[model samples]
Target: MKVADNLAQIQENIRQSCSNVGRSETDINIIGVTKYVTINRAKEALGAGVKNLGENRMEGFLKKYDEIGNDATWHFIGSLQSRKVKEIIANVDYIHSLDRKSLAKEINKRADRPISCFVQVNVSGEESKHGLSKEEVPSFIEKMANYPNVKVVGLMTMAPFLDDEAILRGIFRELRQLRDQIQAENWDYAPCDYLSMGMSNDYQIAVEEGATHIRIGSELVGPYDE
Candidate 1:
């Protein structure tokens, strides 16, 4: 199927998921993950009314940003290297993997303005994931008070690719709970309002659990054509 068709279907799914929980579909933001697709395919997503685009690597993001210009809101959704912070700091609107104090410091120094950041948490306790532990999230958000240039807009996590809905939902639920706990603190720089959990396979569960941003890849853009 074409990108437009895929996007339409995904949007419907999002709407239905929101309705299931008595939530407005507008509460969710579908970020089309265009990391592996070509510029033309990414444009197809834009033509389909998807204004948010995400890339996992710096090079690909820069290339797409050049080709797509300001037509979309860009999200850096991968493990960002501290050394590369200066290169992308001024470009993207959201950084979805702020996992360390060093990276936060670098972002503060490089960002032209306060960058909306999601403090990544490895809620599933996956050794392979690159984020702080659940126990570390509160302290980490507290530390963000010093990094004025980095605005903590939310929290992000990647659930293990599992078929069991119970397990996947647990991980997402944990992230949402953690987000709520942090938001209660009412930290000035960190609103902790958004939950950047879920992807192509598990966005519905994420939305039901209060996810404000869902990063969709293959289910929305499909595989790269060129």
Candidate 2:
């Protein structure tokens, strides 16, 4: 499908989902997840009117960012290691996989420049994932005080793929509630605004619940290779 046509379809779906829950489509931001897709595809997306683009790997993004233009917003939506945080800190607009204090400090050590960052919370207790559990976030949030450069925009998570829609909603709902609680109790350190969840498979449902930023893979720009 043409990039424009695909973008239109996703936008229509976003509007329908938002309307379903009495939310405006304007509130939701669609980030084109371009992991494996080439820089040409990113250009196509921009040509098609996609202003936001997401890449998981810093290595790949570095090579592609200059070509994609300085206007396109770039987000690091994959598992980021402490070793590579410095290089990505200055470039990517947002780092969505921030899961720990150690990583935060590492990102902060060089984060002299302020950036939009999210604390990755593992709402599902899945060992395979990279985020900290809800119980661990408080201390992490506390630790965030040391980082003057990292802005705690909100929380993010990678939902477990399940056959049950209820199961999926439950995970997203939990993330929303947790974010609410943090903001309510810890206004000093917690900043709750962006809920970075959902992807190609589940973004529609996510928007219906309360996802301000959805990292759309697959359906947005098609499959991403390593």
Q: Which runs of model 2 end up more than 4 angstroms from their true locations?
A: 186-189, 224-226
Which 10-residue window of candidate 1 scores lowest in summed lDDT? Answer: 217-226
**Cα RMSDs, all models:** 0.9, 1.8
Which has the greatest lDDT?
1
Best by TM-score: 1
Candidate 1 per-residue C-alpha lDDT over 42-156 given as tens digits, one digit per residue, 9 for 90 to 100: 9999998999999999999999999888899999999999999988877899999999999999999998799999999999888999999999999989999998899999999
For model 2, residues 73-159, the per-residue Cα lDDT tens digits are 888888888889888777788888888777777887877786788889998889999899988886777777778777888899888
In candidate 2, the residue pairs with backbone N, CA or C atoms under 3 Å apart (3 or more residues apart, or in different chains) clash, namely none
Runs in model 1 lying further than 4 Å from the true structure: none
Error of 2 at 198 (Å): 0.5
> Against the hidden reference, what TM-scores do the models get?
0.98, 0.95
lDDT to native, each model: 0.93, 0.83
